[model samples]
Target: MAERKSALKRAPARPELNEKLEKAKKQVITEEQLQEQRASFVYGNAPKGSRITKESAIKATKHIRVVTPAAA
Candidate 1:
């Protein structure tokens, strides 16, 4: 009896997606534009001395730092 050899299968080739990729790339926002939009959302047209809300407090805690002087 002759031993049977296993045949190797080739993977299917990937389809071309350059058009889809270009569309996705165009949809992406630039970092500078994103920053400017976020700044506007956070600080635009806010009333003076408005009490900070919980949402703003969380944002402030995430982005702002407090420094305390060393005790003498």
Candidate 2:
């Protein structure tokens, strides 16, 4: 009996994209940035100089509202 081959062949991997993925995987985050993220999560606001009042937040975001999609 003859063996059947796959109809679809795998595309060759792109070194450029692979390089980008490698760089992303090896990314390093500064301690300051990490601390800022932690502070924001803990305080529910930006740290120190970046602080914005509730009014500012609402105004800046233009009063965002939760949107529920219509059922299909």
Best by lDDT: 2
Backbone collisions counted per model: 0, 0
- Candidate 1 per-residue C-alpha lDDT over 1-72 given as tens digits, one digit per residue, 9 for 90 to 100: 998876777655545576677787889797666655665666654577887554674465356445899999
**Model 1 whole-model lDDT (C-alpha atoms):** 0.63
Q: What TM-score does candidate 2 get on C-alpha atoms?
A: 0.29
Per-residue lDDT of 1-72 in model 2, one digit per residue for the tens?
999998799978899999999998999998566555554454465567766755555444543356999999
Instruction: Report the Cα lDDT for residue 35, model 1.
Output: 56
Global lDDT of each model?
Answer: 0.63, 0.66
Q: Give the TM-score of candidate 1.
A: 0.29
Clash-forming residue pairs, model 2: none
